[model samples]
Target chain A: MNPVKVILTLIPFIWTIGMIPFVNRVKPIVFGLPFLAFWLIAGIFVAFICIKCLYHIDSKNNQDS
Target chain B: MSSESMALAIIFVFVIGITIVGMVPGMNKKMSLEEWAVGGRNFGRWLNWFILAGEIYTAFAFLGASGWAYARGGPTFYILGYGALAYLVGYYVLPAFAPLGRKYGLMTQPDLVEHIYKSRTLGILTAVIGVAFLLPYLQLQLTGLGLIIETCSYGQISRVQAMLMAFSMVAVFVYTSGLKGVATTAVIKDVVMIVAVVFFGLYLPIHYFGSVGGMFEAVEAAKPGFLALPGGTKALDVGWVMSTLVLTSLGFYMWPHFAANSFSAKSADVLRHNAVYLPLYQICLVFPMLIGFTALLVLVPALKTPDMAFMAIVQQTFPGWALGLVGGAGALACMIPAADLLLSTSMLFSRNVYGKTIGKNTSSESMGKIARVMVLVLTTIALLLAIYLPNMLVNLLLTGYSGVTQFFPMLVLGVFWKKATKLGAFCGVLIGEILVFGLILGKMDPVPFLGQHLNAGFVALVINMVVFVAISAMTYKPESNKG
Candidate 1:
């Protein structure tokens, strides 16, 4: 497996689990949204970027082989 | 005509039109069992995307997500977390699954299981369990369709009437066109759902609370702890959200329909692209949650049945014709996914359960005929369950997930770990399922297990992996396993 793709695959878990302990409170709102809501909303977009990166690496891996 | 009548007319016209269009592709083609069950092992990128999206984001997501948001609040964020988690797994796992399907000519989930384990008994068991779990899920869509029709008609039509009319049409289209029919309808269904969701998500908040930001402000003031985890519901804590997210994410791919859909992909690249971009649809899905929150403040007092939150909000907000369009979209959400579920369950029954036991030497033509009949039987059983055994939409889905997720150990480990023995796979799934049933029956799901209040499915999954690994170690016959 490509290291980049592996990292991308792990990103969603890391972001999801990582935010659990700290991002539980609803203060310091970002983008007019509460902290927890913003975290999940941002996480969705970040996950999109991460998956797109994985797709690129995956295509490269396929080509190299 | 009144706006309600006009809207109802639009919904009926759309449903009838889509049914006609949905059957067009399959009308021109003569289908074998493979084609009927798995789209003849040939679907390009966009078609596969539509089918998978249509399958995943069902009426439950359209309605239940909003309901959970409006009612449960913080716990609803679990929906957002799991979409990415599951798609990431799909990115790696689905490529592996597609090649196996192509290589073995596998047409369903149990076919792949039978291929991997080489155990006919286990294959049949998986098929039975898969269909059993899917029934409640199919019932969920029926309930959603019933909600849409009753709400749109301003109580003009009864729930039973709406369910019968919608599902009979779904059963007919699915029996005639099979997977191709489901895919073709999904294209229209998804497009309609996206439009309706976006319109409601943005419009509800702005109309009721001035803007999205203002909506959150009002929610914060009106209901304390509404925007955070461990919201009003005692069971829906931060831990429960995390546990449910992980379990459902892993469980998402284990659904028989999801895996079987992979067989239709034309290439691994198609699956990969779908995995990556599917999260975009997730972004769209979370909007309904926003609508739900807005509904809480806008719809005075509160709705008794929270699952009707989306429909209630749409009825209050949009005029009759637009409401009809929204109703049509919501109806499509239920029908498209329900059709796929019906197709998958019937295929599972015919290919694995009935074919394995009684019709072992039956020709493919006979099996195809059996599958078509099974679709009618399964849908009718689901309709009965919907009518008699009604439950909360998301609750039914979570229960279904807990049972089907048992297949994960056999699926993921069987692919990666060559040491995984067939005996281990069978025993692991059986124990996991029995434990799930015990937990649910005992009302100890999300109970204190190992000092953590994990979802019952995740708890069972842990026990399952341990048993599988231990048995595989004990049953180690390296040469026999290799061949």
Candidate 2:
């Protein structure tokens, strides 16, 4: 398995499931949004970036193979 | 003309224009089942983007997401959350299956199962299961179309009339144009939907609550706990949300249409490129959820049918033309997914079940003809079901996720592990479906395991894994390596 692929997949897990407890709170609003709402919006971006990195790694792997 | 008449006119014009867009691709051309079913395996990045978006973000994304937000609050986040997670899973899972699709001329997800397990019966079984789960989903699109049209017409057209009109047109275009038609219409649907979503998502918040933050603040004050996990609904809790997110995301691409659509990409890298950008669409979903939240806070005495929440808000807040545009977008959103589902279910039935068994040795032309007929047949069934056996949008989709997720273990194990036997795959699917359906029929709480009260679908998955591994261990033979 490509290390990059493994690492990238884990990003969604951490951002979504892992941060649920801490970010699940209603207080400590970030950017006018509750923490949970902000968490989801930000988690999507994080997942997007991870996928972007995976694309780069995958392209390189495709070239090598 | 009254504002309602003008809105209706705009919607009618948009619908007529897009119906033409849907048919133009395969117009005046001879297409075999191959071309009709998989777009001749020639989808480039942009085309793939449109098709994927069309398939993934349906009326469910627009209406259902917001509806859940308006009615239930925080659990609505799971929609986009699972979407992003699904794309992440796709980044690895889908690309792995792409090679097999191209190599074997695979046109459907069941075709992939047949190839991997070398079992025609299993392929047919997979097709049956696909149809079962997919009916409610396809029904969802048609139901959404009916809702959009009825709402736009301001009760000028009835729901049954709207569904019959929309679905018959969709059936014709899908029959004539095939996947190409769905793909083309998807391009239009997605553009219109993005504009509508962004407009409502942003405008509603700021217009009503001053800023997006201000909307959250209002909800937090008036309806406390509406912004947090498990929010205002007793039906959901943090564990349910967390487990559902994990399960749905993991099972995301297992939807038969999604798996088959993977074959539409030009190559694995095209799919990879799509995964990277697809989440941007999901991010835009935040706006719809915001719209839902705004509606919850602003619209007094909450809506009876929350599915109407988004459109009701549009009617209340926006002018006639804006409402028309939003309605047009919603209608197209409904049609795009409906077309894909119609094509997929028809193709699977014709190719996997009928062609392999009763109509063996049939020519590709004959198969294409049969597939078209099946498209009409399946459309009527879905339309009838949509009108007669109505359901909440998010509930229908969640039920679909449960059914389709049964495919996850088989596909994942089949690709990564050579030792996963055919018996294991079969037993796993059977047991998973039985457990899930049993739990549903019996009205039992999903067994508590792993510190979460897992849904029947996920619980069944764990047991299915156990059954698969145990059965495969017993049945293994060196001759099985022939697979």
Candidate 3:
């Protein structure tokens, strides 16, 4: 619920689904792949990190009971 | 033996082997309705993880992703990030429901609604809608099964025959073992599918074009527009990609069966942990799309059925036994989820509708029996429709996917908002379904003015949320009234 957590969550969303329209280009390929493909593939890893950070700080996810 | 016979033998043996593995757990027990539906809610992390991800990764993932990539191009990548995002949403929504699942011993999604709003009628309404939407989806698995077997057998086994065999096996598997069966079988299906997809996805592009980049460059040269959004397609523009992702990710866990499956988790901790790591599974989705893009160029004659790209490429490249592994994995992907859908839908009907109404005093054992009977009835209905009217099921599934997203308002508001009235959820869902079916059935999807790219279902969801909030505000009474 804190500002940091909220921003962390939004980071993945912005990269994965939110920024698709603006970045829908074939040129300026990253690492030998097209821009769109590179963006999508990298987005998964970004989501994984953001979710991992969110999980540790989340009050409910930490409860043992 | 002939090449066809060798492949057929391997495919059938592999399918039956995994079917028995699925049936091994919880055999020889008289399970109650709760036990039958959700493995008595004692599943540990690994088993819990498997079934949670199992339903979404189906025959559709194996063949359909490649098929979409082959036919639809850049549109196929839409499938990639949505699952990860769904888990992101689950990071919040699932923990909210975990205590409720344990506290009330809730068994189905309708049961959650009933408890949230304190209305049995709402429970019955959701159960009916859930079952209706699920049947069409079940039909899709059967049709997918038929295609896999037909391709595996080199046209020796008819699609109808494959479906019939799958139908019988799936029904009996669930009847004997329930959710445990689905989970155990999911292990084999996931393992074989990961191997097949990762290998083919990497191998094909590198084999033909010398590198992944080379393959993409070749595809770009061969078909210039094929590497980006709306690539080689008219309707699936940038808006389609963005909107479809939102619609699917929001609707992902709303399917009736998903709600029921979530009930089986041991604790909130396990489910939350799943959300963190589950996106790793998204890696498999990428492989299929790569294969699809590779298939676009590698085939000499080109494929007639776009959906056939995965199998067509597999058959052309591999030996009999290797192709058999792909075929067997695809069959399990179709069968296990169909079995789970049948079981959970029947449980929702028998428990929420039948037990709460006509069979008030029926024991959980009898309810399980009743659910079993309903399972057979539903399976027969799906089987007949799959055989008689295949396209009808596909259309219903499209509508069903969008229709279930309508539940997002009811569930999120009902749980988090607290003032969400029963009447509000009822009216909102009804109106949302109407808008979804109206726009989709009338073929007005993407709307006229929204660049023809946004999904129709996403449009309905926004409107549904507005109506739900407005109606709840009007109908909410103070706590003192407590009606």
Candidate 4:
């Protein structure tokens, strides 16, 4: 595996672990959303982006193969 | 009808409709035995993610996590804490299992273990333990469903009647759809649960306490320990937290439905993607615990069973329509896990025990038939257990965690280590079971070395690893099966 690919894979894992402690500390506002709402909505957004990235990589691998 | 009874009747009818609709896809498809048992090994990334999440976050997550948070306070955070770490760990571990699952056409954990060990006796042993462990877990899911019905119906519906109603729906769908039923219903359940969590997580605090911050502040003032880590009590110290995290994280994948879903993933990458994306599902839980904590703040002292906290809060805080929606979501949360467990238990009996041992040459149609029969049998057993001898939801779930984690050494290590011998695996498993049962029987109370409650799982894992390594070192190497 490429080192860059490995690091990219680690991003969500690291981000999630970091979020645990930060869960208690978030200031309760994001564009009118409460802190928990804002954080969860943001998580859904990140998940969407990650899914797209994974799809592209998988499709690219399929085309190359 | 009274308001609560009317609401419950509507929810039951809705759930039954969902289960029937979910069974349609599997009924239409003519699946071979392997496909029925393992989803034909063709699930895409998204389907696998939904199914895996549905399986892992069970009635336990809905009821047990909040209940623990309600009763034990900060100690219950270990549920999410361990689950997050488990996802990261699965990113590495599941890939190894994926390729092997694909290679052997394995349908259950026992198939994978037996393939590695080349021993039918070993296979049967693993199957027996897996079935034993899974039964209580399945019963716990049924018990959760029973609680929901009993609560919503205001005890008009007996627990036995409720379990039969719930488990029978699960049995019908699982018997018809197999893994397809589990996957299909999981998608619906996941969407419902996610929406419900988002709504309740945000709405309850604002509606009841003015804000999430206000809710937390009130809880902090009343039960200050609920907000702190490791809980405020000496019983839930830092050591207990660390031990629980380790034990549960290891136990996560040992779940039968997890193994079944792992087998169903199209590729290793799909499983890895699931591990990466799955934590997002935990977001649903954050609010449920808040709901439980809010109940602590708002409710009278006598109404304190953690199992009833969320329901009590909903009854007190919400209007009729909103309460119905919460009831529906909680019902789905409990039902989805119940359905998954029923399907997985059926697969274990048919594929691992019957197909591999009793009827080695069973045809695909016959195997599928046997699976359906086993689903009925297991559902009956779980319903009976739930009706007569139901346990406290949280402790019952913990007992399952301890039992399932006992398989970790064999399943996890067997895949990566070519040097893992059958004898070593057997010894490791034997000693692990001994320690687990011994601890359960009070042999290691006060924890021989550690002054903590000493999770039987952690002790069993230590013994398992030591025996596995020592026995493997002394035994001659087995011939490589791979070309």
Please give, for residues A1-65, the per-residue lDDT of candidate 1 as tens digits. Answer: 66776777777787886677678866766776778877877887888899898888768877999
Docking class of 3: medium
Relative to the unseen true structure, what is the C-alpha lDDT of residue B25 in candidate 2, on a scale of 0 to 100?
A: 82
**What TM-score does candidate 1 get on C-alpha atoms?**
0.96
What TM-score would each prediction reach against the true structure?
0.96, 0.96, 0.96, 0.86
Which residue ranges in model 3 land beyond 4 Å of their true spot? A59-65, B450-452, B480-483
* Model 1 alpha-carbon drift over 4 Å, by segment: B388-398, B449-452
Arrange candidates by DockQ, highest first: which order? 2, 3, 1, 4
Q: Clashing residue pairs in candidate 2, if any?
A: none
The single-chain TM-score for chain B of candidate 1 is 0.96
Which candidate wins on lDDT?
Answer: 3
Instruction: Output the lDDT of residue B371, model 2.
Output: 93
For A1-65, candidate 2 gives per-residue lDDT tens digits of 76767878898888887777677777878998788878888899899888898788768877999
What is the Cα-based TM-score of model 4? 0.86
B1-483 per-residue lDDT for model 3 (tens digits):
877888899889977887788778767777776777888998889998999888768988988899999988887878877988889988888777767988998888999999998889998898888877988888888999999998888888899889888788888888888898999888778887888889888898888889888888888888886889889788888888888888888888899888877888898888889999999888788788888888888787888898888888887888887777778888888998898889887887788888889899998667778888888888888888888988876667879889999999999778898679988899999999999999998998876544556789998998998899999999898782265
Tens digits of per-residue lDDT, candidate 4, B203-227, equal: 7778878987787766666764455
TM-score-based ranking: 3, 1, 2, 4
